[model samples]
Target chain A: MTVTSPEKAKIELRDVRKSFGAVNIIHGLDLSIEGGEFVVFVGPSGCGKSTLLRMIAGLEDVTSGDIFIAGRDVTELDPAKRGIAMVFQSYALYPHMSVRENLAFGLEMAKTPAEEIERQVQGAAQILKIGPLLERRPGQLSGGQRQRVAIGRAIVRKPLAFLFDEPLSNLDAELRVSMRIEIARLHRELGNTMIYVTHDQTEAMTLADRIVVLRDGRIEQVGTPREVYEDPSNLFVAGFIGSPRMNIVDAIYAGDGRIKIADTVMALGQNFAGVAAGDGIKLGIRPEHLNVAQSSSTALRAKVDFAEYLGSTRYLYCYLPSGETITVEQRDGRDLSSGEEIFLRCDPERLRLFSTGGDRLRSANTAGMPTA
Target chain B: MARTRNSSARRLFANIRYHGFGIVVGLLFLAPLVWSVLVSFKPSVEARQPPLPPWPVDGFSVQSYDNLAQYGSGIWTYTGNSLMVSAATVVASVIVSLFAGYGFSRFRFPFKNALFVLIISTVMIPFQSILTPLFLILTKLGLQNTLTGIVLVYVTLQLPFSIFMMRNAFDAVPKEIEDAARVDGASVLRVLYRIMLPLVLPGVVTVAIFAFLASWNEFLAALILLTDQNKYTLPVLMAAVRSGQFGTIDWGAVQSGVTLMMAPCLALFLLLQRYYIRGLTAGAVK
Candidate 1:
């Protein structure tokens, strides 16, 4: 087989839809992944991330649509003939075969020359650092070692692309992190288009060249990690992307570029033409964005309910008078006891507004909005 | 110190009692077999006497075996017939049940569960009740009085249990293994032969042993279906020896035949007992 050019390695999904009986698993979705790009699909369970990956791998059938790999329509092709390899969550190693046989299985099936199969197997073993484990069976190896054998099996195939289905989920935490770095390094060294599925947002943030956030079988946002984190397109993406999660407070829109939260009314430093005066809206702010205010009249008053100390920083879980809870990241080393009264402030420019229906309410000055 | 010593003594007594009961049960099962073996070694004339001093008091001899060898078209012919029929039955049953079990465990089609239940339901219908029908079917197929007929009937009889064991064995293997193989470019038949057969070997051994023993020891079918004297299995020959020639019972020949028939079954069970137990309990817990 000839090596695929970078241009020919692009994957395109056109209007893909999957349904089982009367229930729909994936709604119509269209995506194009560029050659040599590392894309991560992040979603909650049942959001069809893994299902979509399987469909692309040809392990699952497409109810309707076309899937293109290396510019060829392969929606109905066998998984092996589609020029892609997948590393499964369970490792899916043949328990009876040695690590060497496991790596050589696909090449043997393809009827490659005996010497070439040996060389490729050795190369994959060297790449995964599993050369010492070539004679051991999958049952005799640890979780991480089995995972390397699984990846080595995929690598020997020299596929046009690689699909990973939550491959690190079964390992211990420390091993997961190390394997994650190894996978990233592998992508860099090989420069192949790779699509990864995971529910770990930290992994998505750290590994993805581009992150596709999905919810309920629909794409919520597609962007770089920083873009999705700092400028989410909607409320779901905003709430789902961050670690300690962005805090949301119920607020009423007051006219003249202002919003009323709990009892304090503050200028938002932006004009919103999508909302009327006295209309209900949600105020979004990240934990790190909210700070302990130093005697400001415009600050919101809250009582600290708890503080979680993480050595370098603390998270203050506070409750407003209206019974709304919020978390504030404190890094100044000042300690505040539970039930202590405190004032919180956020930069006006950092505030985000959302309609009650969960869509972002863009400010008037942003593109595609009418100025007030 | 006194309490510890008393407890230690009590534990020792309990241990002896437990093992003593086990030994009693073991001997109860082995005693008849041991007696038959010893009686087969007695001289032809002394074997007819009372059971006192069960061993050959006149001196151990091959006279009973020689006597058994001379009865009814000779012993080797019947032994060969039994061996061929039993071996054919084992091979046929293993192949048929393995494919059937893989299908039932892995594939989905209309009436799959219902069909499996139907196959398994045949086990409840006693073999005696169906023997006449089977005989008639074999006659229609021109198989009566042939070793092939006996083998066919035995394989059919072994199907329900063999397939059940094999399906359980296949079900115990994870489906992801097959998926992985297919993704690795293995064809379906290759997957079954190269991967699945090794994993389900214990179940195959279990099926083969049951089929061999059942066909080897079966007497009624051989008697009812076969009309030729040369086609008699060992059990049928044993029955003839028990009836005796002209009102005189050949106790020596009968004891020798019994001993010979018991050897293969015991050896097979002992040799593959681990697989048999594992296959029996394969899906019982999971």
Candidate 2:
């Protein structure tokens, strides 16, 4: 198989918008995917991730704006001519055809020579490790085997880019993990641009070179997995990326880089020049960042509502004095009983501040100064 | 041990009861065909007598079959005509309905739903009511008194139902399969011929059987449209044989003709029974 050079696989969407009669699906959106990048579009259902992928694949028409693939304007091209292959969520293999025929169908349609088609089919079969099952129809294969055949079909095309629409969504948990790894390895070996759309955050975090987080037909954040998880751009990104999700608690910003949570006031190490004293702000912290602290004037007091044990770590579901609940990741394996009073504290640098309107508030200075 | 013995006896009785009911029902349906076949084998003198102990009481003879063979333009000519008309109808109906069903199930165009409803609604119109107009139209087109004309009429009559069955079959296939084909570089026609036609084979078989049976057994249209004695189909020829010479019905010849006509229909339904059942219930459940 010929590798697609990174330069020849770039895909760009220019002010694309999709509407269905009276309702709009994808608002005007522009995005450039570098060649050979494994980009995952992660969002909840109805977020237009699949719609965007379909438009790029030419399966769905672009309501407005243009799609350029490999420096060619392919907005009016047929799906086959777009030089992209897609693996559907359902692994749509032709039931009547053998696995070999399903993989060779595209080349046959293109009128390639029989020997050449055979060689390519064999190569794809070898790559997907499905040679033994070539003569069998799709009905005889397991779900994972069928998915491999679907991908193998795409591979024989040697497309410039591959688009996968929740391809692993139908597999069992163990198979999903293995297939995810196989897909990641496929991208690396082929060096083709890939756009994967999935609702599973684990898939997005583990497989994406860059993740595009979407919500309500709009992009919420586009960043590396680590970047999105560690430094979310807004409250939505912060809440959507993590498993236990970031703990968000309402706070009142005090003068001179200090914020008050319930009855406890702590010094915020970073300076917030735009914040005013007594202004309502939101404090965001990951579950792992919150630690059980000794009772002190600075530590926030809370009652442990529930402790969930997961063999290695426990999650402390705590209720603050203000009646807001937050989760803490306790890694020391110490168990805390429900209804016990506790105090929680975190390093100021591990904190994130969000405006009440859901935008992230960047710190104004790096100087560490206690503002008690 | 006593309980086990009792349960075994109950099982045996249940089996006997179940199979006994099945055998009675099966024999009830088979009785008419079996009786006609047995009577057709009887001597003309005995077959013409009142129906009793349906089989030939005396030695069996092929005299009735011999008489049937000598009817009209010969039984072979009529059988050939019926086969030709039925074959033509099946081919035309299958080809037209296959494409029509694919279009109805997959494509989008202006008034698509309305067009489909219009095609399907034709099934509600009775064939007898339109026979006069159809005859006039065939006469104008120079197709009257022709086997092609009979086939054309049968195909038209078969279309509404054949297309319905075919559409249901095509509709039951997942749209994703077609999408996968199109993305795999198959053209519209290729997708229908290679991918789709194979998947909907049972539906096509069902449609073909219906077309063949409809054209084969039809008497009114064939009688009204065909003028030549050489072109008379089995059903028309059988009608003529029933109203025998000088108003004297030949019971032996009628029995032989009935037995002959019943063969092909029964054989076809029995041969394609699996596909027939599946095609009827294609989209009814899912």
Clashing pairs in 2: none
Give the per-residue Cα lDDT of candidate 1 at A311.
92
**TM-score between predicted and true chain B, model 1:** 0.96
The regions of model 2 sitting more than 4 angstroms off are A1-8, A262-266, A273-279, A321-323, A365-372, B284-286
Q: Over the stretch B1-286, how does candidate 2's per-residue lDDT look in tens digits?
A: 9999999999999999999999999999999999999999999889879999898999788999999999977999999999999999999999999999999999878899898899889988988999999999999999999999999999999999988888889999988899899899988999999999988989999999999888989999999999999999999999899889997888889999999998999999999999888888787785
List DockQ for all candidates.
Answer: 0.61, 0.75
Off by over 4 Å in 1: A1-3, A6-8, A294-297, A367-372, B1-25, B52-54, B283-286
What's model 2's overall lDDT? 0.91
Give the chain A TM-score for each candidate: 0.96, 0.95
Tens digit per residue, CA lDDT, model 1, A1-372? 344584239888999999988999989989999888899999889999999999999988999989998888989999888888899899989888999999999999999999999999999999999999999999999999999999999899998899999999999999999999999999999998999999998889989999999988888888999888887778998899998999989999998889999889888877885889999998889999998977566898999999999998999999988999999999888999999999999998888888998888888778464221
Candidate 1 per-residue C-alpha lDDT over B1-286 given as tens digits, one digit per residue, 9 for 90 to 100: 9999999999999999999999999999999999999999999888999988888898999899999999889999999999999999999999999999999999878899999999999999988998899899999999999999989988988899999989999999887678778788888899999889988988999999999999999999999998899999999999999999899997988999999998999999999999888888887785
